[model samples]
Target: MPLDEDLLPEARKSYRYQWYVVAICMLAYVFSFVDRQILSLMIEPIKRDLHLSDTQFSLLNGLAFSLLYSVMGLPIAILADKRSRPLIISIGVAFWSLATAASGLAKNFVHLFLARIGVGVGEAALSPAAYSMFSDMFPKSKLGRAYGIYSLGSFIGGAAAFIIGGYVINLLKSVDAVTLPLLGEVRAWQLTFLIVGLPGIVLALLVFFTVRDPRRRGLRRDADGGVQKVALRHVIGFLWRHRRTFAAHYLGFSLYALVLLGMMAWTPAFYIRAFSLTSSEAGYLLGVVVLVANGSGVLFGGWLVDRLARRGHTDAAMRAGVIGALGMTVPVVAFTQVGQLWLSLALLAVAMFFASFPMPASTAAMQVLSPNQMRAQVSAIFLLISNLIGLALGTTLVALVTDRVFGDPKMVGSSLSIVYGLASVLTVLLLWRGCRHFRRSVAAERAVGEPAAQPEGVS
Candidate 1:
């Protein structure tokens, strides 16, 4: 997957625009998470206003969003493979941004739930297109770094949701409520959603204008050297032919995501309940950790893997993922078990750091293993599986354990421990298996041919 081999003439000559594309895509990813994750910080107010239990709120946060996000990603991704990826991304960004604003206007649980669904559908269009574009823009060697940089949006957006949301909520708490001209009085939570959602419209326009779709790489061409349209069945057949590699990849990452998303959805509540911190306090503290620790982890992991790959380690990305999974387990378990706030936060920070590693690696693997024509579809399938398992179950499982098993809402920390600890163990096992299959897959591809062509002066 080295860039020298896969990059087109235009891309090989102009490296600056590639970085610009990554930056813009990263911003789109940032806005996606900001709109999606702001809900976690607003949990208390939302629960109170809607008269919801932990289980009910979990449904709104997890299932309502994940269902549409997972189901719709495939078709949208297919469109991305065939059409203008930037344009598709622009439409998605605008749709999700509007949906996020609409969330502020919801008077009831159902309305808010529907808005979240829209947000899910919109956000689904992003990563597949982004991943495909990155594959075409960068050489295989830099895929890890490119994806890692793009993935920073998750932490940045999550942090912004909390830090910004926390400050806004704190500022507005003293006042009863703010009255909008036509909207009448609005709660602090509603205003928080509105403030975060509107700016993304401008971001969408920026994406439309700024990001260019690169020529597709690593595609199967006809006798005339024209790229063929990859059929859906062809994509399915490719996956089936390499089922073990994909199975391990998908299952392993889904397990990792189960732990990651579970922590994200409930850590604020865990902080509130365990340390008696206010929502804003919890948001700000965790926000800082996510921005710093997760951001650092992603960059470090991507750089490490790229360096390893350059040194002739074809399985470097999978190795990094395995190490990350193992490293994350102890800190996450300890974070849940610890009673001291400082100790717990420290543990949580370490856990987030390691948790960030596997994602860029996973993304790199997807690009390396698939043809360019099939890359978007493969990515969509990955997201669909990961989100369905991770987003759909991550929060709900913790809530179920708290409400049903512990029979107490305050035992959320224990529930997180139970869920994440088990998931981490499973993740380690699956990733190890995946590493073996991934290496074999890489060898198989290399044996078939040297990459399309190694461009001079690209690296």
Candidate 2:
């Protein structure tokens, strides 16, 4: 029930040291995403070689990774809230990296599915723990920028998956396969998996050695001024009390995620199919858009939130979400309908810029709303729902439309347009309404204080 003085991040560390940790943690995040997303570029090859349909391939890309990735986040987050955060993250990086390498060994659909699940399980550890660490290490004023910088890894890793992975795919075209020392034979794509997946182990070691868990700041305390681990029921009650706030955040941003990640997952395939370009070409083009357009967009989203918060806007996150959704809707919808390649790419870049806002904004919203102890739990819950909607349902939405609605794989662009159009409208409406609820929730929390107990008869 007592606070641990040695666990305090501010006790002996300088701001520079704090930022160094953020950088390393961001690198780990980069590794996690590269392992998670490299599968996007290999979609056609994997589908062709494995003798699978679009829906089945979607299962491997979305369901297999996201189902466990989202679900396993909760227990891992609970452990993060109570244990050594960096050590937990380090183990996760290693586990997922090994899993990525193991994906090269897959001989069939089932083998690949299980390997993807392993990658998901390992990745489940990084964000929740990293978020918990960042919230503790940085002050509220600087939180958005810190998270924004950290969130940059998603695009950076994505770029690597495209640019570097593209180069590998291109270079391997002449060769049929490579034989390794222990593994007798491996496919070109399999070697790509091996190349991208193995470096994460070293990053894991860097995280474990250099980073230590900071003392729990902003802990929920009782009348006696003693700290206690929040019980499961209490966490539920707290969430229920702020139900509208969490609902908007979960659904609104999730719809945003559904569209954002859906684009990322399928856009490469769209280029390959629509323009008859190779995967490497599509990867190179999309990789640049992802790095420059989406990357800056997320950073600007974080800066926007911080600027709004500085200007006394409590609903900054929701406001930014709405703004981004509005900016993205038309371009995303029109991008897929365009016949000219240059025009389509331009619209897609515009769409990507606006699509990346919710990354940092959503995290900042939750971390600010929940107390320190409940941050990871709340984040895990959000991730579970968001990833399900974002990756699982989002990817499937496109594939399902292509398979069932259009009955043609070449119509993937049309399918992407339809999903993005619907998702964008829903996102704008939800987050617009969320701004009012978020403001009200911020007021109520301030009035009741951080450890607000569930008041009776609200249900």
Candidate 3:
């Protein structure tokens, strides 16, 4: 897997600095998530204010963000490959933060859609760059934990969106509308956007100042020892060579993303409709669930990935993914079927725990399998596909199923169950096969690397 020789690896600084880099990346990720996810809790107000149907709202939720977000990742990731990652990430953080606040200024559906597009473009700068950095900073054996630690920002941001937004929204409920100095009158939800979105700029500054781009390690080289050209064509060629491994990795993890994101996007609506709880109440409860259940769940999954790999499980990442997908099937599908509130919540929490496993697993698989030059490009392509499938198609599918098939808003819970259940079955099958392909790919890559790793003229 170290196809790019780490024979001349970068000298690592103190462990604290390594963790510090991860910390900064994680913090930026948290702010990015908050800026995006705060919209979930403000759904009712936005729909009511904008006069949007469920489908239109779903379009705003999925396509508006994922469209440009998916498309732009390639170029941004390309930049990350050769450029300074911390600067790229800092620019992204500032841009998205402003975009999110700009969401508060949106007067109509088109306005909000445009603003969401901006958020998507900005967020595209993350992940690939961060993933590449993590691999360079830590050893392959520890990559899963590093990525998992970084990924907690998503859950933390999700929980923050709910907890913080819930309190602000609840407080604003007492007031019918807030009148900004120049923007005139708007609802609490509008102001809530400004409240949550603008703070990320500060975090952007922190990342810019504190996070240094680690020296790039494990570079692929030509037979004569010159650095190999890093171009889009090279990445394409590499993927073509390992088609089976990537196809399984991309599709399987994407389906898992579909299941996980589908639940996160719609669960608030489900809680509100099925349990007769207010938006604030749903936010508060989901906040706890996301933090306690999802937070701990991902950490455990990362730990398990490292454990399995240490035990000589070459396909440990994919194996872990299959286990997670299987574990979630019953809980996720059955949660909505239950009538009792407590039982439903319990099932929901359990599903969330297992649903989180695939993220770090996916990252570990990509970084460990590919050479360094290809990491960000390959990662960008996966993000493009994954977001389009998971966020765009998955969210839109749930909304369409609710609107067209069920023809009722209240059946959203059933729609979620139907979508998630099917996706779960599909994810398990793909990832189960993925384990074999991944093992073969790893073996093949190691064979090529062994001879390249020999001392000069040893042969």
- Backbone atom clashes (below 3 Å) for every candidate: 5, 1, 0
lDDT of 1 by residue, 197-269 (tens): 9999999999989777888777777779887778889889879878999999999989898888888889999
Which scores better on lDDT, 1 or 2? 2
The worst-scoring run of ten residues by lDDT in candidate 1 lies at: 449-458
Cand. 1 Cα-lDDT? 0.88
Give each model a TM-score: 0.95, 0.95, 0.95
Error of 2 at 404 (Å): 0.8
**Model 2 TM-score?**
0.95
lDDT of each: 0.88, 0.88, 0.88
Ten residues in a row with the worst lDDT in model 2? 450-459
Model 2 ranges with Cα > 4 A deviation = 1-13, 451-459
